[model samples]
Target chain A: MSEAKFSVSFAGPLVTLQDAGRPGNMRYGVAASGPMDRLAFDAAHAALGNPTGGTAIEVSLGGVILNCTSGAVTVAVTGGDFVVEHGGQKRASWTVLAVSEGERLTIRAGRAGSWAYLAFAGDIVAQPWLGSHATHAPAGFGGGAVLSGHSIEVKNTALREDRLGDIPQPEFIPDGPIRVVTGPQDRYFAEGAVERFLSSPYAVTDAFDRMGMRLDGPELDLKAALSIPSEPIARGSVQVSGDGVPTVLLSDHQTTGGYPKIATVISCDIDRLAQLRAKDKLRFAAVSPEQAVATCRSYLETKQAYLDQISIARGTLEQRLMRENLISGWSEGDERAAT
Target chain B: MPGHAPKFDAIADHAVLVSFADTISDEAHAQVIALDQALAKNPPQGFVEAVPALVNLLVSFDVMATDHAVVIMHLKALLDALEVNSVSGHEREVLVCYDTELGPDLDAVASATGLSVDAVINAHLSGDYRVLMYGFAPGYAYLSGVANEIQVPRKTKPVRDVPAGSVIIAGPQCLVTTLTMPTGWSIIGQSPTRILTGDPDAPFLFDVGDKVTFSRINRATYERMKDGTHHV
Candidate 1:
């Protein structure tokens, strides 16, 4: 095990250690507390060519800063538009960097995303609870949240052979209605409740956390009882409480709940929903389960395409930029000359 | 009689929820346990996990390998082959202290139930209970079969910071708190025994369908057990 270490100079309140999460343990009431933005987490790992299931520091909107204290390791940052400064140099969100001893890396909340991930080239050296390093702070299961002054260690650090280069910013579908699969409990709602839910725009409330996101919208009237017999809930389940408010359960949600869930946000859309900050207004669009599955497959394909496109540059940044066409009506030479 | 035929609904693209009954009942609980055990014994391809609740079983699968229809098909076959009668769970004994200091709601529950404080405790002790499911928080087991006489509705407002090891009851359910959190249930007693040991291999003391019975202990014994000086 290589003895690479990074000491936390600053960390956001919600920053915590996470991997793919501890699945199959929900029956014990433990929610699989993985990354809020799973696609970004995977991207960070893919950028470093590290195997999946390794730990990543899940940074919330508050941001975090770290300093390399010992050894050397390669790190990748992905997710939300976060300003990343590595060793006094500004780096893009989806970029990989190598850090040596005494070098400082700072990440602050940027204009776009709410969650980001910092993944190391090697395995993080935190003790795993219940076969996972994902922290469920409410349950106090994993290792709890990462804090300032904490030294994070990575083992088996190996540098990539090819020098890293510029990465194209990933494109997402323009913000539209978030797709959802209506019902496991849509029957509980009044006849027009689902239609109203789909039609009305809901503002993301400040009462958001890893557990669930509360939305302020038209009250969904239930035809059935307010609370059903408690049942197992999925990550994207939109459970409506007695007050007729809908709250979308997230990664850290309890395994089961008593509220009647009207619909479940499709897996592919969960990452998108997780990125929305408080007061962001969004609508829900109903899709069939088959369509949801198909969308998920296509989403995975897109992510794979992004991973495949990541390659080390053979030339300098300017040369690499000049090699590709940058303008719609002009040649690369003209764009370079203008720059 | 056997429970109603299970109804499968797609909760997510990767998850299917099989409802055994419309409301909570022994038959539904049995069916849930039966299905849970059957799936554990022989999980199908792309099987992720099966979470059993009061009257339903939620089966999540890997979307890359299987979708809701495939999972529902697999679960239907598993259900057809399941031996419901074969489902049986282990029994566990919990030691609890029912002192007024530890159980702040004891007197209130007693008055509400039109019974003496000692009678309320006795009723709680006399009841037969089975682990219904785990939910709300880690290792928080919801046990069924709180005595009808002592059963009461959940508090309209939740009391925050209810400590771990609290023996609480609401409606027909009883739960031994595993974490300090807000609870709407009435705290009837406090258990010294650790329900959540924090061990990865076996973090929880009780499992769904486990038969749990409580034994009364004095304040001294509770203190001793809490301090690790008492073995029983």
Candidate 2:
């Protein structure tokens, strides 16, 4: 068996390994958590010829440097347009590369987005808690956070790892209105508050992370019978805290909440919300269930199109951009030039 | 042009909330329970979970597998089979400890109700509270029908984390916490019984309709139960 291992040469703020996520455990009060950017995570895996569901390194607002041992291993790097280096040489973001054993790979500060993914040819190595490899940043992870000097391990898989050239990045990562569905508690807010919520624009705040995105904008006046029982919160549900600052819960949100949920961001659009950086403005548009389903279908089709491709070339944006392909504009390249 | 009123309003893409009125009354609650039983006896394809709240019944399903029309058909059929007041709910008996150390809010409850500490405990013990449903925490059940003397309004401010197995009363209801929870209820006691554990090996202690009662225990009993030396 060919031996492979990785150790962090430089440690950044917050980095962890994540798979698709642990589903079917929400009944146990545990949240289904995985990569914040599913499209990027999938791209990295597709490039490495690794299974889509294996755990991979999720490098976020912070970054890291790593080195592998033994034979040359194929690695796929995707997510934010960060500066990446293989063996002291700078390379384009997104795409797979074969690094010789004992060579160091460096990831610098993120320029376009918040997080990135690094998928090795082999399965991501981590303790699977609750049937997932994703790290729960809020609830100090069961497996330790990625640290310097820790030896990485991977599972034995038979798929051949393939290297791909960069694909051309696309234009217009959409910043169009983030659509939401009027909720069970829409009446809790005043008529004007509801209108303001629909009419006004909210900007994603800097104090954002995997846990939640704090949106800053109008003070929505919500005055109802002083009591509302806390209910189970869903991902992308817009919950207004006491201060009226609307925060959107993400992958790391708590199982339940008491705050009035004025609206729920459809599952497909949530990926768009996740890609937004702090200070990026977004409009809220209410869409019917039909529209939500249509959006979801479009995204699924796009993902299938990319996965169907067998061979990829290096240094073009399409190789990375096409692979990610989240609809409603959640991609990093689109976010940068979005008007 | 819009079609004539198609019966119930759409609550969401894949779920519906049939409402008889805006508030909870005996008739409305009975109606809710009837719908719950009918749905349980025969659920629609892709039916996920059904929760009956004070005045409404919330039905959820996966839209990917089941469309809105089929779910609506199931809900309408459930209402049709619904015989009012035909359903019966089972009760849970939760064993609890009532003492100064375990019952931190005992004195406060006694003072608010103008009853002695022991009197408050006795009244609480005598009342048979029905388990409304499980929520607020993983297996934590919200129960209705606490004695009037034990009932108290929740605090203006909520605490961060109430311990696991906390037996507390808030308003007309009391709750047996199944997980470590943040609550505003008056703590009257704790239970030697653990109703919930996330691990896969253990059997689930309480269901939706099990009776729960309180039993006072000393430090020795608490230790025995804590260390697994005590068996149910």
Candidate 3:
């Protein structure tokens, strides 16, 4: 409790806090409300040695200016590229930073991507309702948008860390076809619609958000897309609504829907899509559920290997690069040197 | 009684969808629930998620490292091994106050079915209802098995916002609203009995096979219950 501090500023579209999410409450009509980018959320916390269940500032594409009041803590920024500043100096993301009391930390928008995570070293300051601090926007559980001038209490846990490894750049990420399986109401559409759906190269439209990802591609021709009563849909579920637009359900999606879901994106690929901003081109490949499971395990294994390499590189260059921005040779700037 | 195997195919790279039938039916629903129960009891490898729908179960497993073709085969084997004949005998009875004031649509419901309000109440109260499933809202149960006399069509234009605890009836079924939601169901009476609560130990008071019942209560009881001075 003594380690917890209040927020001094919220510069962007910030929310209370979130983690992997609130699950098992779906039976009670309560959606599992948690963070948008589950993979990044876990990765950030893992890098900080924080529990996966710990609370973190889930910032939207719009960045924020967060200032803590007390206790020395370790913090990490993951998900989307965001410019972070510590004590008015340019800081870094995807890596951990140890901060003292009363320091101002700012995270501003950078290149591409939608969401970002600011994970504290300890438990967040808030009463847990239904076992999570992550906001369920629709349910109105955790309050929305961390606006400027609003202050939130954050408790610091015992964190002992001098420096974390190097934060990897964007391209270091892997790219692959998003896998899918046919949906329950999939038969309601015309014969070829499902085929076209599996083969078509759909672009993630600008209409993407935490609630749903609207895809743009071939217009599905359904002989009879009867309106059925709204039923349950899970995250990563690709539901083709009445208007023929395919929307991939995400974290903030409703508990149930009436649309005809032709396919469901694989769980492993969802994080990849979550990192993708609007207009990102991606193709869908249909595979069996067993195949999806197999592929995801391999993909996770591949991702783990890359992360391991990144970790090794960071450890080897800990003092020279990651810890201190040390530049040995090159006595002058490139422009000046060329002159 | 046709003993048949449900068709299953990959819905995504990581999820395999097991369909009991082309359309939702009692037999299909039974098969799905039984298979879902079996899977929950013995889940697959890299098995990250499972969601049961009306006539199908969407199972997501780790596909990259594991073999999906094999996993689907295993699921088909498990399905072949299950018995789909029984309508699960489990029951959960929920208490609700049914009256005109609490149920605004009681008059319309009775009128639509050409029955008296008391008859409507008797029909609703005397029968056994199956808990169709939990969705729409937290702990809200979409129960089936209403008598022919209590059936009514949903409002052409649903309400913009229906408060929680609203007992609704539409199309030969009854649905309890656990949260404030917009619905097309005919609003009858409101109940103080919370079908949905946030206790993990008592996660859900009603499972899919449970039954729900309604009891009549006066305005005094409603007010007292609303004020936390009474319980159903």
Candidate number of the best lDDT? 1
Error of 3 at A180 (Å): 2.7
| Superposed model 1: Cα runs more than 4 Å off | A159-165, A172-175, A308-339, B229-232
| Predicted model with the maximum DockQ | 1
lDDT of 3 at B115: 89
* Best model number under TM-score: 1
Chain A vs. true chain A, TM-score per model, equals: 0.89, 0.85, 0.83
Candidate 2 chain B has its poorest 10 consecutive residues by lDDT at B1-10
**Candidate 2 C-alpha error for residue A152, in Å:** 5.2
Predicted chain A of candidate 2: TM-score: 0.85
What is the full ranking by lDDT, best candidate first? 1, 3, 2
lDDT per residue as tens, model 1, B125-175: 998999999999888899988999999999999999998889999988899
lDDT of 2 by residue, A1-339 (tens): 554677787767668777887654433344567888787777777766666677888887678888866555677788768778986678756857666668888876556777778877776567766556777665534343677777777556322432555633423234578888777566677678767888998999987887789999998877855456545466677888777779988877765556777877766566657877889898898877677656555555555455434224332455446655644333543444343
Tens-place lDDT digits, model 2, residues B87-202: 67655557777867888989998999899999998988887776555544345566777888778899887776777777889887887765555777888887767665444464
Q: Write the per-residue lDDT of candidate 3 for residues A203-232, one digit (tens) a residue.
A: 888787667889899888655638564555
